[model samples]
Target: MGTSPDRSFFPGSHWLYFSVYLLAFLVGLPLNLLALVIFVGKLRRRPIAVDVLLLNLTVSDLLLLLFLPFRMVEAASGMRWPLPFILCPISGFLFFTTIYLTSLFLTTVSIERFLSVAYPLWYKTRPRLGQAGLVSVVCWLLASAHCSVVYVMEFSGNSSYSQRTIETCYQEFREDQLAVLLPVRLEMAVVLFVVPLLITSYCYSRLVWILGRGASHRHRKRVAGLVGATLLNFLVCFGPFHMSHVMGYILGESPVWRSLVLLLSTLNSCVDPLVYYFSSSGFQADFHELLRRLRGVTAPSQQEGSMELKVQKEGEGQGQDCTVQTV
Candidate 1:
């Protein structure tokens, strides 16, 4: 059976991991929930394809954030799995599954945007809302199926360690375990990470070129922000984790630094809100409206009548914009 590492490569860094996880949980949870509310509200009024995809992306981020406290607990225990052994695989499955779901949903959103801009006439002819729902379901199934390997490797029956003896949740692969895990990891890296990344890159590049030719400066800037955030998410948050998959396959063991790089992946949950803000004018309008209402609530001395009138006008404006640019 595979053996656990002799010692954590960064013995004193568990606090760092815990701190980052705490911060991400605090920030990502509310943002994603807010995005969820906004998307649901918009969809209830009028269903749009991009909004459907964005809603799924918001849900993916929320799932990742919800399962993150498990990691936080493990980190607080200095990267040890102190909880019941059963919790490890459950949380790990949701954690890894949702991470890849983010990649797929983001790629789907990019494709939707690219098609809307690059082939507006053809895009309109399709039944987009139904298509987006189908795509979302497929992405979830694909990621969940791929990540189920977590359960397989964890319970391979060859491990010498019993539940009480195992120190880590998903680390310390034995030779037999590594033989199966490493190849699967490499395949996941190629299929889930690299392929979606290449597709996103191509779609965004073509998107920029198409918009540059005749789109307004404001439109171009919004697209630029969306593209930049999505790519930055792939490069900064996910790049290192998947690279570790490749490196682990080649080295025949998980790298000592693999745990540290996983923190970057956790950070993606917090970063996805920026993508939501930039990708949808409806989200921006609703977000700003929420802030305005909060301000009004806090400052009761402000003329209630005037504030209500302003909000009404802004809502009307938002409705018009949502009709034109729901994507």
Candidate 2:
């Protein structure tokens, strides 16, 4: 096979690549880990249905963050993969896997929330935690299975030249490779992003209509921010990566553009914790306390006092206010 029109990712502005990935690691790691720890406590205290999905989202982001340093090194190495050949595809596989997992989990969260609010009567009648766990497990399994294609395709001589002496993780794809890759990715974008995006949009749109009417301005702002942030994440971060695949398939891969878009996608990991903090009690409590300690605030339980946080009662259907909109 001959080389495609695009030889490789155009190497320029290495500093920008290093900075974006570094920023993701610096902010995403501690916050996601803290969310996990706090959620563990919350799960033990009283498990909320959405907590399972949110926990999985945090885990997925954390997994993605783990790969950023290796990616940063590759960027610094003039966009050449300096790591082991095996590790390249593995990291790439994990990267794509976790991102789609985040999408599916977010979709599930929206659906669960819609059910809880739309039909609270039927929702409270059953055990929700078990159902949520089942959904979480299924999403992970499905996303992982779907993402196996990355490794399979890699081994197929599309991504790396395993047969040759050179072992690159992500190399320029030829025309034939792009022919196979583009359709697969377009399909994935539909399943992983497009469909789920529509589902989440419908769910959140309806929820906003229902929940926004009687809610306070503060509560409305939190819910609105959650919706806005999630949409912004998909559109700004993940959207271009997939769209680039479509455009690249049509116009040939611009490795530089794709690489830059991919970096932006990782920023979602850092942004998700902030979304979780404003939308969940456990995340808020942990983050608020961390900020207090950082600021040298000595008052105990001061977060609750200042925030005037409320909890969901046994019979309440609206959830826990802004924090109640955990989706």
Candidate with best TM-score: 1
* Top candidate (lDDT): 1
Least accurate 10 contiguous residues by lDDT in model 2 = 1-10
User: In candidate 1, which residue pairs get closer than 3 Å at backbone N, Cα or C atoms, i.e. clash?
Assistant: 2-174
Each prediction's TM-score versus the true structure: 0.87, 0.81
Model 2, runs deviating above 4 Å: 1-11, 157-167, 252-256, 290-327
On residues 1-327, what C-alpha lDDT tens digit does candidate 1 reach at each position? 333434556557888889999999999999998889889999999888999999998998898888889988988887788888888889999999988999999999899999999999998778478888899999999999999999998788844447345678886676888899889989999999999999999999999999989999989989989999999899999999999999988888887777778889899889899999999677799989987887889777568777899999999999999999976
- For candidate 1, report its TM-score: 0.87
Give the clash count for each candidate: 1, 1
**Superposition-based RMSD of candidate 1 using all C-alpha atoms, in angstroms:** 11.9
**Would you list the C-alpha lDDT of every candidate in the order shown?**
0.88, 0.76
Native-vs-model 2 lDDT? 0.76
Please state the error at residue 148 of candidate 2 in Å: 1.7
